[model samples]
Target: MKTKIILFLTTVLLSINITDRGSASSNYFEADVIIYGGTSAAVTAAVKVARTGQSVIMVSPDIHLGGLSSGGLGFTDTGNKEVIGGLSREFYQRVYEYYQQDETWQWQDRSEYGNRGQGTTALDEEFGTMWIFEPHIAEQVFEDFINDEGITVLRDEWLDRKDGVVTEDGRIVSFETLSGKRFKGKMFIDATYEGDLMAAAGVSYHVGRESNDTYDEEWNGVQTGVYHHNHFFPPDGPHIDPYVSPGDPSSGIIGGVSVAPPGEKGSGDHRVQAYCFRMCLSDHPDNKVPFPKPDNYEPSQYILLLRLFESGWHERNNFFTKYDEIPNRKTDTNNHGPVSTDYMGMNYDYPEASYERREQIIQEHEDYQKGMMYFLANDPRVPREIQNEVKRWGLAKDEFTDNGNWPHQLYIREARRMIGDFVMTEHEVLGNREVPKSIGMGSYTLDSHNVQRYITPEGYVQNEGDIGVSPDQPYEIAYGSLIPKKDEIQNLLVPVAMSASHIAFGSIRMEPVFMVLGHSAAAAAVLAIREGQAVQDVNYNDLRNDLEADGQVLEYSD
Candidate 1:
């Protein structure tokens, strides 16, 4: 009887913790705020929580810290720099400070690199910020932020999406990970690009483009004929056939080109935009690792590209157009042209796929991209001049040191967007409607990459769903978009995957804007905890005040 009592007491103590604040054991962790993600927004949100003298735990699936910001996307897509304030601007300022040191520029001298950017200079001396930098530097800055705040971060901890969340009366009490580790907190923030937690919590969300009629907007759904960027096969330039053997229908459709008919202009579909790695490449001989052929390289995949070159598209000499140069003689190479790095139609299932399935999809993308590079650089079918230029560039030896010096995070351009109290549409983005309860501002063009590459009725291959509509001005993002319907979840905030129409999210999904929303979401979470109110019930005026106090730009004047 004595032994039984001692054993029972020990088991009880290990299972439960009783304290005003939270506690941490081998299987359980408790904190005032729990953030799930490793994106730029996740880092900013964690910093905000820790700055308010609260206990915060970051449950991240990424082994590295920053998602796209530090994952080889050094060339920032800052549409308007004025609207990017708070921690987003602070991140750029740190980049500037790091570059100011003489030793920071290694392969290339500071004066040797051109200071170019999207709409502003890369190195802004007056603003004390730098928009362009190396991948490792951005990762270091994120690490420094975590270290400065003394925040607790658990890396590579994936959420158990099957049955991990414990909710009572619309509040999330705790969520367990795949390793049986559970996290309990007063407030939660879903800063992931995929919105995994938001979906697992049974919150309503949308996976694909909503019909324009669904949101009463003009650009929400399928856009087959409208080609805003130079990412399409020019009708007059090249009539590249989609068939494997030129014009033979029995030869079957070539790889990367779909056979389905392009859907109606205004109709909705279950398709998603393409995804690719924002590769960091170096031209410097000492720091460049030549592109290697993937073990499962498929030469047949390049047949379409070879046909495009054969049909005279190679005369443009635009293969390196998107190789935007950053510091240290490296480049943040992104997708360009009709058939580039953007793996079209390959990621439609990634948003809702299981962990093992998502891994397979990711591997497919990696193999395709690696093989494409090797084909371009070494394959005899490639134009000689193009192959020579491709051979000059290779993966940066200093970036993404692990995983064979390749970026660990894929550019998940768009994913599961939460359907919450408010949904931002094109009317709000184009300044036709006023947004209520501003939490942040976004100024990027309504941009969506090519969603599919299909055979046109004319038997030629063409890309569809690429859009780039500029906003009338910097627009406010509503606070209501961050929270689920008041009845669904009371203590959770989703800033990265906030409620927005497909067109609206195209503009609102910039990295700087995400950090702004993240800071605002954390502010709201902190306020709700202090007032003992639901996240949806937090006063907008108080949230605005808190955001402004934290240097977040919630409104635009010019």
Candidate 2:
């Protein structure tokens, strides 16, 4: 009787088409190309594929489209504008178009704004069209790409890195998301700054700076001799005391000093540059979100900033410069003076941490930054005039409104980089050497923010690793940088993780460069699919011809 009952239940389950209890049958969604990330590169890659009449899907973890470009980073860092072409140029052109409309400037008049939208001399005539822009305008362009190209975008769907289902043939058969949705594609482009997909695919990548010996390059790690940016106290100014203990060893070093042994000058260490929220602040009272004290606010955290102010180190020049005549009193305030909001040396573990731990770190940074602002504005210790100046500005309400009026995106300047076939070193960037098979070009200054905050031996705080070296001329970005070493991953292209040294990547990592590389990578991916070859095996001559025909610049000029 029991056997019959069990058999009856099994028969009923089968009849109901229930294969496994509480588990839905696995399914796949198909696309010719899949671009992972919501960055400028992801947009360009998807648009390029769609323009070629191929089906493409962009899977982004962001609710918004453009990464930093649309996320309150209005001031663009376009290196060599000439190297920007194809869809990348089209993006800037679209920004120009958006500004041309009289209605676009409801907050400010068009005549008063002048030609600030035209950008600087760095713009390439054949390709460039106004690089600097507002956040909303950038978002509009990305939205236009999606609407016009018919590209499918899955926003807020994060990739499931572990056990994400890559077939044995080395092709990414399908990638499952955290929510159990599967994205199946023939070719994949890892356009994220974090290189999450590339790491998940088991591709080899490097996170910290490679030691000087490892790369045999001059600038790699432990660069104590190099102080490119003016982070230290000016030589002319009265030297600020660096510690709570005067000449005593017990008080500990002032903030922003390296605690570790300087390490091998050229050896690799687990340190990526700094990260900050590119705050869009406004003086307009009606549109400003007044600074609020963070929940975990602590007065002691900002002692260094207070000390700097106490020593008369007051200058607002550290705030990023703006293009002339842009409407709306909004400033793209970046990480300024030491101890001013950038949680230096605290983000080292973020790239590799679990989601829960990353959240904690993000919260910690948020608190540290928010508290810094509040301290500047309301702390009794601050100078009255400085506090008044800070009070004049607040978060832009016209910008990101979802996260309590905070910018939706965190500025993750750099993260895990794929150590692919071609590692673009400083020699390739400084015109000391050239890379073969150019697919794109980057001309921005090799800029790195302070990596560590340590106390100097003199008891004063010192910031290190903020280097800004200009590339005298534009340089070609190697095609090899876009592809993985032939054997690791056959069908993957990493425009964001393109082969480049830390310093070279400092320039190539710019939004404009990423977009250019994205377009090139997509074009190459489509060609590879048609020609039946791995991405590395794609014919360079044919690829170059196609890129040029598509309006990509491969060389740099004055």
Candidate 1: residue 545 Cα off by (Å) = 1.0
lDDT of 2 by residue, 1-558 (tens): 999998788655543332232235533456788888999899999999988887787889888988888887777776546677888888988887776677777666655544443236312235436666667778889999888875767788888877775755667676888877787777999998788888888888888777777767777676754677656555445555656665666777654445665554566789988887777787778888888899878887777777777676666443223312234666677776655656788899878776678778778777777888888889999888878888988887887777876776778887888888898988888888869899988888877787876555554556667778887788888888988888788889999977777877887888888899999999999998889888988988898898889889987665
TM-score of each candidate?
0.96, 0.90
lDDT, each prediction: 0.90, 0.76
| lDDT string, candidate 1, 1-558, tens digits | 999998788556534432224554567788889999999999999999989988788999998998999998999999899989999899999999999999999998889989998789999999999999999999999999998986778889999998999888999999999998899999999999999999999999998899888988888788878889988999665588888788899999899998888788878888888999999999999999999889999999988888888877768757789999999999999999888899999999999999999999889999999999999999998989999999999999988988788999999999999999999999899889999999999999998999999887778889988999998789999999999998999999999999998889989998889889888899999999999999988988998888898888888986
lDDT at residue 329 of model 1 (Cα atoms): 92
Clashes of 2: 13
> Top TM-score: which candidate number?
1
